[model samples]
Target chain A: MRYLLLVYAAAEEAAALDTRLALELAERGGLLAAHELEPVTTATSVRVRGAATLVADGPFAETCERLGGVYVVDLESLDEAIAVAARLPAARDGVVEIRPVVRREG
Target chain B: MSSVATVFREEFGRSVAVLARTLGDLDLAEDAVQDAFATAVERWPRDGAPANPGAWILATARNRAIDRIRRDRTLAGKRELLARLEREAPPAPADDDALPDERLALVFACCHPALAVDAQVALTLRLLGGLTTEEVARAFLVPEATMAQRLVRAKKKVRAAGIPIRVPPPEALPDRLRAVHATLYLVFNQGYGPPPRDELCDEAIRLTRLLAVLLPDEPETLGLAALTLLHDARRAARLDAHGDLVLLEDQDRSLWDEARIAEGRRLLDRALALCRPGPYQVQAAIASLHSDPEPDRRRIAALYDRLAELAPSPVVELNRAVAVALAEGPSTGLALLDALAEELDGYHLLHAARADLLRRLDRPGEAGEAYRRALALAPSEPERRFLAGRLHELPNGG
Candidate 1:
């Protein structure tokens, strides 16, 4: 099954990574699959009321940087998934958040 | 073991590769090939060798595997694996054509992206190039145990992931090929760099030749070969009788290997003609320019500029800055280093570069400080000595 590998970095550190390198890594891609996201500060959130939709100020948490990017990868085991996660460039500087994606029930 | 069987066991990896791809089960094919060798040891001497030793072995292994599959608990899976094996031509080791074709698959297999970068190099050296793990480890300056672990982990990952044995699809091949190129170049660097001076250079050259043969038309492969030759051509001039480094300009150009330089330059010209610029090609171009009787500083500087543009990093910048120092002047290079020093504080070469520029500018005290910093950050004894020598040469001997 494929799982999402989410990268989170310190805001300052993320800003420090050379754009050329980061973009090259994104373009070169990796074995499973991955993509880099814009910085977390630009994120928006939403909430629901009985008959109205409400927008929040930002992402679920307030931190230096959050959800730097996500990689969806097909792996054989959780150990393998963790291994792949650990190798990500961001993993050297930040936390790599791994979560199983729930399939939609039709 | 019979002499013939011993020879085959010594050099039967290509056989295993063909069997593995044909069988579509790397582990099982490995086992079957081993069993075939065992049978060969028992029969080759008595039978005076079959009309075709490879055919005899293949037929025997195929029959043995079929027999085992008939009794296997996972009959369906075994049957599928066996069917895949049947798709490949039976081993014909005596036939040059069959051996090269099978070995070609093995080369691609060794370069599988599923393998970790380190594993790809280690495994390629082991299986395809017939190198021991110790030899491979020594080439990379890593502990043998660590190299073994890397190889084991990579193969385990491949098996666990069920990585297909076939070459990657066309769309995916470029990245996969890059990984392979990087691995080869890494191994080559371990040989090219002046130090340890072990016989690993021979092994590296052998591996590159194999890669060139397997990837006949790849300009990058040729570029890699050229890079190795050009870099190695200057090996004799890099050190003095006491093993101290002799800076390029001070070294005796007569010590350079002319034949290797000529070959490397020719290959580099062809690679550049292809117009597909890559990191290796750029590096080869730099090496080629340096090999000339009167290396054009402008050409060398321009090549480094392109290299920095292609793969911009503090390391590239530092190298290019050296060329810039040569082509332009110390002041221009010093300005560039001054700007980059903060970002590359922890990097040894940065301090070394700064120290060099400071020395040229007659700022001996600052140069001494930079040299010391570089000595502290250096990973090897030789580099530390080089830095220390620079510091000792300061006017006040700081």
Candidate 2:
């Protein structure tokens, strides 16, 4: 199974993380891919209405904790995904939502 | 005589647990076991009981489950898993000792911390107690549909989250053990409460005993078993012939089970010998004190003092005050009760205890008022009747 770990953290908490630490954590967690998002200030939100595409300024919603990074990892079970999510530094300061990726093929 | 009902009660948990292990699906295992039991109820009387009822049920349940899996087109993706189970399904164990006893694992899984406490209790009863969804819903006073959805969601989480259907490792045992203990305690209390369900109590005790065997070195496990046994020993004296509440002092000590009391005391001794005084051990100790022919009120008071330090709560303080009243005097207990008034205003037992102390001190007026307050808050008929009786005893018939 594959899970998308959406890492959210306070701005300052996300800033404090060095590349070395992030890489180390990703390696330890068996992360297939890890991407640190740009600051929430640079985010552009998009939504699809009945027949029109709506655009918004700032992130999807205003919140103290912002989506700071994401990790895509393959694991045997949701328990393993949770374990990996707990390892993310952002999880200490904010939240890491683990969502199983729907497999298109059986 | 072996009846289908007796066989169902004895074999339900064992069959479900073993089937779950083989099928790797709790819901399917439960369904299969239910079907097997239903079939037994229909066929047993006409055919006479099977030579080996447990094995018969297991084999029938297994065959039924495999057939269901094979026929369900929606489970096409799981064809490989189903095929594996079909090939590897072993015959049921010949003896009780050989039985898989997967209930321990099922309990741990059901009580996993990821699920809400309410959901955990419901799942434990449904899965381990072999209760129907409606029965569980009725127990918790929820609608059948609501409970069905809750169980579905919880089971989905268990499967999706890959909560292992096995005991946790030693390092993680402490935290997981608390959840497991809390569920078992809730089960036992439900059965021990008014309009008691003896079967639930028996199931809880049996499961807790299994837990004790599985965790032999864990003092708290043994403490819990002791606490349950000690309390259950007094079951015969807990209520009157009419099922009204009977206070401890008013209960006939002769009615208490001496064998169970001795067993409880032995377990308590073992738990205490571990030199680890946890909440359950403290509670068992208090029960032990209460069981004595000539109970030492002063010693019980002192133990309550220790317990307050270990796990302080309003309920404990209320109990401690009652012990102090016996050890010291009514006035002293009254003072402690007064301090807890605001904190425990909504609690009927606190009010009842206060009323008792007040009455003992010859303050009939205040005692009457307290009794009224307790009567208003008391939920059960027996408890309300007991309080009303107390009120009627007041001067001028409060």
Candidate 3:
């Protein structure tokens, strides 16, 4: 199974996403990819409404906790994904939302 | 309570636990076991009983699960489940007769922290209480559909969240054990409350006894088992023949189960010997004292003080005041009760206790008012009747 872990944190805290942690997961063949977002200021949000395309000023909506980073990891179970999430630096000061990645496997 | 019902409850929970351990899927385990029970219901009467019902149930449920999985492999993630099932060894002939008791694992799964507390209680009852979803819903006073949805969501969360279905790791034992104890206590209390469901109480005791045996080293487990036993010891005396409430002082001593009281005292002593005091142990200790022919009220009051420190709740304080009234005087108890009035105004028992103390103090007027307040808020018929009777005893109230 694969899970997408989205870290909700301030840009400063999200900037602390651990490269060493990613490398460690990669070594274990569990890390598919992980990235810290550049910054919210340089982002644009787009939505489709009826026949019109709407563009927004920021990433989705401005909030205290922005979408700071994301990690997609392949693991056998949700517990394993949670173990990885617990290791993320952003988790110390912010929240990490874990959603099991939908897979179409035979 | 019949022969068949006894066999059904015992077999249902144990088989689900064992099968769940082997199959690694709660829904599959439960469904297959239900299917097996359905077959037994149809076939047992005509064919007579099996030599070993546990083995028979396990074998039948395993076959049903494999068939269900093989037939419905497209159900997402079940392909993995089927593949895993295929790799597992098939149940042996009569050698597989006595299934390993892995009900504790099912217990941990049902009481897993990932699920909400309400979900935890309901799941424990459904999975371990040998209760159908409808029975569980009725026990908790919820609609069957709502309870079914809650159980469904809890199982989904347990599956998707990768909550392990085995006894928790030792390092995490203390916290996990607290949750398991609390869930069981809640079940027992629900059963012990007015218009009581003796079946739920029995199930809670049955499971907690299993827990104490499995984890004998854990004092609180033994403490909880003791607590339930002590309370249940007086079951026959809780109400009159007409089902009106019977105050403890008025209850016939002959109706109390001496053997259960003795067993409860022994368990409490064992828990205390552990020297790791907990709220359950204290509660059990109080119950043991109450069971004594000549209970020491002073000690009961002091234990309640300790209980307040341990649990820190208004309920404990209210109990303490009752003990104080018996130990000290009605005036002293009444003063303590008055302090708790604002905090426990919503609790009918507090008002009832206050009325009793006031009546003892010869203040019929205040006692009548308190009794009326209690009668207004008492949650059940017997309790209301008891309070009304007390109100009529008051000079002004009559």
Candidate 4:
């Protein structure tokens, strides 16, 4: 199984992922990919209508917590994914959303 | 109990857990288990009960699930599962005793932290408790459709979020088990009043027993078993002949279930021997003390103090005040209650306790006011009547 951990943080707070935890996850072959996203100011939202494509600036929603980073990990279960997410430094000061990665082939 | 109902209670969780482990799908496993029970409910009486009910149900459920997969071969994402299930060995005989008791795994998955507490409870009841959606709704005092939706949503989350059906590792065991215990405790508490829902309490205690056995060394598990058993032992004595709520002080001690109390004490002793005193163990200790012919008030008060320290809740504080009043004096308890007046302003029991203490202290007027507040805030007719009866006994008809 695989999960995408979407890290969210306030605009002013720089959410830092723990390097040791990230290294351990990678070493254990659980961490597939990890990256910090550009701030919400650099986000571009797009919507497709029947014939028109509407483009907007900033993140998708005007919320205090903005999407800051993401970690894609292959794990045994959602609980394991959550355990990994909870070890992240940002989890203490922000929120981490876990979404299962759809498997095209088993 | 009817043989069918008895079989369902004993075998549902085991069958579903084994099925889910083999099938890798909680939703399918639950549906299959339900189908198996429905079949048993219809057939067992006419066909005569099977020798080994659990094995009978498991074999039947596995066969039906395979048949369903064969019938619905067009469904997407099931082809792989169907192939895998087909490659497995043929179904065993009904009397086969090799059925894996994986109910603890099922319980853990149902009580997963990702789900909301209510959802966890509903799922546990509907799946592990062998309860129908309507029965679960009635237990929770919600509409059937609401509970149905909740079950569907919870099952969907269990699938979509990939919450695996298995026991947690050692490090996560305590926290995960705590969640499981909370749901069971809630089920028992919900069964506290109504006779019709008393089965919920029985089911909760039954599951707690299973947990204690499956994880024999977890002192908290043992403590929870002790707590539920101890509380249940006093169920028969909680109300008077007039169907009125009986206060602990006024209840007939002879009515208590001595056997259950003895078993609870044994469990508590085991928990204490572990030297890992948690909230449930502390509360169970208090209940154990209360079960005594002449309860040691000071010891009970000391246990309450430990409980307050462990849990740190206003309700615990309130109980501690009562225990303190029992051990020390009403005036001391009254002083403690005064400190919590602001925090527990709306709690009826707080007012009731205050009223009791004031009445004992001979402050009839203050006691009258507190009794009136408690009466006004009382949630049920029995509680209101109990408070009113207390007031009626007061001087000047307070």
**Residue-wise C-alpha lDDT for candidate 3, range B1-398, written one tens digit per residue:** 12345578787888888778766778988999899888888878878867667677777887899889878846666766767766755556466444677888889888876679999998898887779999988888899999999999988887766677788678667888898998999899989988788988988999898898888878999999999999999999999899987888889989998988988888888888999999999999999888888999999999999999999989899999999999999999988999999999999999999988988988888888888899899999878888888898788763
**Candidate 3: segments with Cα more than 4 A from true spot:** A4-47, A55-97, B1-4, B77-80, B90-98
Model 2 stretches with alpha carbons more than 4 Å out: A4-29, A37-54, A57-68, A78-105, B42-51, B76-79, B83-89, B92-96, B396-398
The lDDT per prediction is: 0.71, 0.83, 0.84, 0.87
RMSD (Å) per prediction = 9.6, 3.3, 3.4, 2.5
Chain B TM, per prediction:
0.83, 0.90, 0.93, 0.94
The candidate, 1 or 3, that scores higher on TM-score is 3
Top candidate on lDDT is: 4
Give residue B397's error in model 4 in angstroms.
2.0
Per-model DockQ against the true two-chain complex: 0.05, 0.37, 0.42, 0.52
CAPRI-wise, candidate 1 is incorrect
TM-score of chain A of each: 0.70, 0.77, 0.88, 0.89
Sorted on TM-score, best first, the list reads 4, 3, 2, 1
Candidate 4's displacement at residue A43, Å, is 3.2
Better-scoring candidate (TM-score), 1 or 2? 2
Ordered list by DockQ, greatest first: 4, 3, 2, 1
lDDT, residue B191, model 3: 91
lDDT of 1 by residue, B1-398 (tens): 23654456334666566665665445555566667778878877787777666666666666666666666775446656666656655556567445434655565666776566777877777665656678778877789999888877766555544455666666656776777777767777766565744455555665665666677667787788788888888888888887777888888999999998998888778777887888888898888888777989998999999998988998898888888998999989999888888899999989999899999999999999999999999887777888898899899996
Residue A66 of model 1 has an lDDT of: 66
Per-residue lDDT tens digits for candidate 4, residues B231-319, read: 99988888878778887878888999999999999999999999998999999999998888889999999999999999999999999
Query: By the DockQ metric, which is better: model 2 or model 4?
Result: 4
